[model samples]
Target: MKVQQLQNAVEAFDFDINSDEHIPELGRLIADKQVVFVKQKLTEERHYDILDSWGSPGMSPVIAGIGLGKLKGLHWNAVRNTTARIGKLIDPRHRSRMQSVTFQKDHKGRALGIFTNGKLGWHSDQPSFESAQRVVGLASVEASEGSQTTFLSTAECYDNLNCEDRSQVDELMCVNRWDMISKNVFDHFAGELIEEQHAIMRYNGCPLDGLTAPLKGQTASGVPGIHFPGSLFGYFLGMSVDESKKYIKHIWSLMDKPEYIYTHNWKDGEVCYMDQAITLHARPTSVDEGDMRRMWRCSGYLDKLYPGQGPMTMKINVEGEEITWDELFKRVDEVRKAEYNRTKWSKIFHKMP
Candidate 1:
């Protein structure tokens, strides 16, 4: 494949994207370049097949276990079937698209995708999870005219930090939760969310609730970078939400510099893959409702780099204490059950009145 640089990202030209021979090179390009774009027409099935070559598609079983149900002790086929059904029940349109990426609504007005006409905030895909997807791929199903997706290389940002800043970032932990409207990312710059956007926020926030991870993440090659979840960020581990905002914004400033950023204008029959572990991407431009901007998006680990490492676990920082993922999952479960009970009771009381 012929390659050329596109600002901070790289663009590949003239290659068989679907060939197994090119898959390794494609994976390496995404890792080294952080973002690699290619103009190639791909079907919905082809888009998903390319991602499957990288690793397991859709949500990592580790995160899915918390939302869908425990995936332990299930056969591989059974697990896939179970998750597919449960995932569909959670969001029907998303399930139809392989539960990989969001899309726009159809003529029937049924929410076909979570991504509507709005400017998305800067962040990696699903950074709230301990085992967040390592790579993200987006294909232009319908060219996103009049909109651009900007990407920033956090790995480069981390490398440029001074000794003190680097040390600080390494030791820091940040809390991420999606259940709260206050943490809604789409509203980062925009005003109040419309009902559809609010629903999207809830789904995005539910999978990895009240979890903490190091502010720094590493590429599979061991290059360190910022693990920013954008507006989904709740707070730092030891700092109050108000206190954490100062630091979060400060760090965000460093990454947003032009030297580390690239903005891509989409075209029909174009596909791009980005290293989610080492990059933050944004949609700074707004899309009108009538625009035919749609993409087939996928995020997962690259099998060549992260093989057979499903159902991964990590140590989570809570307050000043460190806890196992299992403990955190249990705590989240209890809180969810309690919240469900309160809502249930409130509904019953309203009927009585």
Candidate 2:
């Protein structure tokens, strides 16, 4: 296996990803470099295998469990069987959200994947919530031409800051909300707020008010870096509305530097892993030939990292009360169950095999 440096990423060529001996080295590369690309073909099951080796599978509620049916307005058990009917359920791990980003639709004209045709803004998955994934991996499946996934490492951006800006960033707090996130991050994109998307978020238990620290741990390395969720940003904590706007502009100007950015034009069968704590990514263009392109995505914490060093450890507040990450998810699960029973889709779908 050989490795080379891209502008702000590390590319591993001829690497034996399936070999157990190489897993530790690959884990190190992902931790230190924050972004690593391996040019190799991977099936959906294999994609989950690599991520699972690192830690727990970071399942997005919207894409997993009860939220899956809720998001599509279908019955949960029905969707599960529909997924299985299309193909055999090869493994139990497949039950976790191994999201496919595609425009293709099923026979009933339902989209086969999420974010089928849109320009995704600068953001991290689950940015507003404290339960952000530690690492995210994407495997290119088919026809990924004319599209690019761009990434920016806040760790690099933080290192570039002057002492004054760095100090201010450390002391500052950021407020993130689902309601105003689209307007702040995707001002240029049409239809900023998709109501169905927000409804799914609510069903999955994402809070409206998410309090975050501007500077937090970047990776398992435990180095401090800016946690800049530009998309989900509502305002800085304890700042006036007007003052927050001005301050955000100033902060973004510093973090969104050209030197810290890397844009990848994907090739088929390639996989990219990103350390979520330190980085922000975006799909810079809308899918014109959406049916032709597909990618598999999974995110979760890395096992190689020290315990308590993951995103779940971040100090975050919901509403006004501070709670443990597990506690938050438990509460959300309860709400999801209530909605599932209330909707009666549970009965319809679960009644099937």
Candidate 3:
């Protein structure tokens, strides 16, 4: 979607996106610019308010075309390692590895589960980290001849239920260690996961069994959000051993309802980004990973976050010695300046003593 055409689409929708004003550009900016941006403009003056009502400056518009707009296709995969080369660099903070590299077949079938495939257990992303959200990007290289990227917004999910389900989740937490959840089968494991002894280290993802991220959430207009722990299955809030299992069955039964799902039919080059906070997504699989199904799926959080608290720093091991905070900060600044343009974090490697 060309930049000018994006504005035109909004105008065509009769939302009057001011052309000569100070509204921040609707989509991404840098090396990820897009040729077109698709958005549902608002007739109400509270568009930002609607977005704000969702909480934080994290709303993603479906965008097509190339350039920065293409970043939307990136979803939330802003990590720099395509080959999983940095698998060695992750530092496990617990007895279990905090993330999952994911087996191509045994688990989610390399990311394909065309409709007839049974329901995916509900869960959120990045619940293991100290952070509250993760950026998730999706680009439809192809779709099930008729399937879409189906999702259940946590807000919508929690909102649709009774005040009782909401109350049960008021003060619960789940654990995110891999060993505590699933078995480690991938031989090509990240050094950190191995060392940390994690069972399945995917963020906020719960084991198909039970066990989930500890109490994690956010506040929107004073309404609180409590996610069902992935590890513990549907038991996170108040469901019991049998009840939790039943709860899973119940939510799964509701999968076919249109009000609870937003299935995305991917455009060849278009990308979609979403705030993990408001959305829970799943793909009905297609072929298998090695077949035509192999779409490069890479996931990572920001190598450095500019959290408003300002200039946070950490010392990391590089080439056998710790890189000082001063050097790390300088490197982070350089990275932020060159954001979205640079590939490979080898520049940080060269700074090794």
Candidate 4:
């Protein structure tokens, strides 16, 4: 398999999983390019094999209970399942993770699932999770015309800033929060089931006051890059929400330049991997309703780098009291059970017709 550089941001090659050097070389290329693409589609076994080669696959905090049994992995099945069924199938314990990405619409033109038909704002996958996957892989099962995935190099974004701007943000920390109860569509259909069912859990709750690292940090290979979390960012420590917005906008202005971005129009049978820590990716609004687009995503932890570490501590507020994360989740679960018992028959009755 010949390896070639694509747009300076991604390295592309046809994968050969059996070659002794391929796996190591793949690792090296990912470190250098921040993203890599394989032109060939992989079988299910090969797909999992490639991911295992990196590290233990990270459990998705969004799609909860559907597991690969002893295989210990998860799959996002947007193309094959209906929106309501997908919503009903998700394990409430993992409801906070972003739901499926799709532009599918019903005959009436209403959005059919968790994601809207509009463009997804820029983000790295689940940056707020304490066990956030260090590497993410997506394999295309189908492709849509006029739909493209864009990527920005945070390290490149950081380097382009003036020295003073760099110094100002280098020591700062961003307080990231995603109120699963507020931002997600699960509750819209299921009615706070996740929150009520104690599914309002995250690996780590919000960052503690005054605890933060640079918005720019060193990559696994010791390369400095921006770690902007985009929409997941709530506010920067030591700055008011307004101040944080202005600061973030200023940083985005520098990073948004054309030369810093790479856009890929995916084709069927292609797979892409990205170093989630140092990059931000987005999808433009896909307007073609007749087109079918599908991709399978999997995540893996950074456990190899930090051995024997357990789940990070989390915190949350319950009725204005700051409580332990576990305590809060217990309350949510209790609420869910109560709500489920109250509505179970009604839900079944609604479907009976």
lDDT of 2 by residue, 74-182 (tens): 4345445444432222245564646676766667655556556667777666666555677888888888877799988777778878888888787776777656655
User: Which parts of model 3 have CA positions greater than 4 angstroms off?
Assistant: 1-123, 130-132, 141-147, 176-216, 219-226, 231-257, 293-353
Tell how far residue 201 is off in model 4, in angstroms: 13
- Write candidate 3's Cα lDDT for 129-151 as tens digits: 22333334333343323434555
lDDT of 2 at 242: 79
Q: Name the top TM-score candidate.
A: 1
| TM-score (C-alpha, index-matched) for candidate 3 | 0.43
Q: Write the per-residue lDDT of candidate 4 for residues 194-217, one digit (tens) a residue.
A: 221122123222222222334764
Cα error, residue 91 of model 1, in Å, equals: 15
Candidate 2 residues lying further than 4 Å off, grouped into runs, are: 61-92, 182-206, 211-214, 310-316, 325-353
* Candidate 4 accuracy as TM-score: 0.66
TM-score of candidate 2 on Cα atoms, chains taken together: 0.80
Evaluate all candidate structures by whole-model CA lDDT and list the values in order: 0.66, 0.66, 0.33, 0.54
Runs of candidate 4 with Cα error greater than 4 angstroms are 14-20, 60-118, 179-214, 287-290, 302-353
Q: TM-score for all predictions? A: 0.81, 0.80, 0.43, 0.66
For 161-231, candidate 1 gives per-residue lDDT tens digits of: 99998897888877776644363444763233335444334433434466666788876556678887676
